[model samples]
Target: MDETLKDSKKLISDIQTQYTRLSKGQKLIAQYILNNYDKVAFMTACKLGETVGVSESTVVRFANALGYSGYPKLQAALQELIKNKLTTVQRVEMANDYSDENTILNKILKGDIDNIRETLEEIDGEAFQEAISRLLKARKIYILGMRTSFVVAQYLGFYLGIILDNVHTVRMDMGDAFEQIVRIGEDDVVIAFSFPRYSKKSFQLVKYAKEKGAHVISITDSLFAPIASESDNTLIVKSNMASFVDSLVPAMSVANALAVAVGMKEKEDIKEHFDDLEQMWDKYGMFE
Candidate 1:
């Protein structure tokens, strides 16, 4: 890294450091980025130029002035700065601003569409396959999700439970976290979910699972996400913000895909489980 851009981690501070040296057009772009980096992170160079009323060339030049190779590097640094810091209240406010042109429903749905598109484009196929392999070989599998992510955990656990004989869903409640994870052993694997405004307890739980010798696989929004950073494997999911909600659509899609993969891997056993389950349902007249 160039000395001038070494403070990429300190985006705000670097902006301040370079303030006096920036041109008038650069100043405008710099100020907009500092004030609205969360929004800017997703903008294309052309979009960013439009937002700041500069040419795309100007935007690229501003990035070079900051000692970055190009606009993408600068934008990525901006993302890292705000990734875990944006609050739900802030997201709601952003949604309000973005929903002006479209109906709230359309606006929100479009955001989810973008999220799923981006997630699919960037998902690391190798890591995903490794995660499936880990799940298949583990002596037991523990699924964890906390707070907003609990739904994702339950979805994964319920589907995987039928495919794997030894599957457990570890609740995020502090009281239950330890009790559930205490017995995790070397041959076990833990699939954990965590997203923005990350839970400290989940972080602690993943760490504990690691200490207990479980192979940890994380499903999260970013590689920099605390849980993903510490895990042996991570599945990256794109989460969009819509009215203070972290869109779970992409996360759920990832869950369903993983479940199907695991099921196909254990098709013989799962077929038997389904057969028995079908009989039980028939016996109880459980269907509508």
Candidate 2:
């Protein structure tokens, strides 16, 4: 990891610090990136150069001038910088900025596919295994999500609960969410879900959980996410725009994969638990 990859650090600061030393073209690229960082992260060097009316070589040189080994590395640093910094308005504007591309459905689907691919690239396998290990070993686990992220939390909590009896979800809508989380302790684990247009309330809940000394695992879009900064383990997934809604396909998939991985890790016990659940569900006709 490079110095610019620090989640808590702002890449804009680096750009500004080097402003006096940059060439005219380099300054142009830096200014454009600073202005449209959220959009620039997803664009290619060619696209960025075209947008700024510069040659691709100029962009590459600009990245080198910024102390990055290459354009892709510099792009990654910029992405890490603005990953969770965009406001809802910025997201809508960035989405509209690219609205001229393909059909709506095609764009949305392609975006989802790209999100999954980016998630695979950004996510760390070792961290994933560590999360599964910690989750399995925790005395109790609490999961929380707000807004669209809540659906993913619910899905993960539901399956995780079916496998482990100590799983709990802090449902804010039910009004007792804090009551459940107020008892979080050293042996407890809290898994939080957050995405673009991140919920301040959900992040507050994560803070509260941390205050109570629970180890937190954050599933979010970027390392720069506030929740990630607060978490014991941060899983940076990818979710791009799909019309007005935030594309949570990759986030949901990450949750599902984590749940399944945990299940596989405790296969024997989980299998027995599921066998009983299957019998009970069959007896009660829970599914048609």
lDDT on C-alpha atoms for all candidate structures: 0.84, 0.82
* Candidate 1 lDDT tens digits, 57-130: 99999989887888888876776567578776766666545645558767778888998998898788999999
Which predicted model would earn the best lDDT? Answer: 1
Clashes of each: 0, 0
lDDT of 2 by residue, 169-275 (tens): 88876776777787789999999999867788888889988888889999987666779878988887877555457888998899889889988888999878879
Candidate 2 Cα misplacement greater than 4 A, ranges:
2-4, 7-9, 34-44, 83-85, 97-102, 241-243
Query: Where is model 2 poorest over a 10-residue stretch in terms of lDDT?
Result: 1-10
- Against the true structure, whose TM-score is highest? 1
True-vs-predicted CA distance for residue 221, candidate 1, Å? 1.0
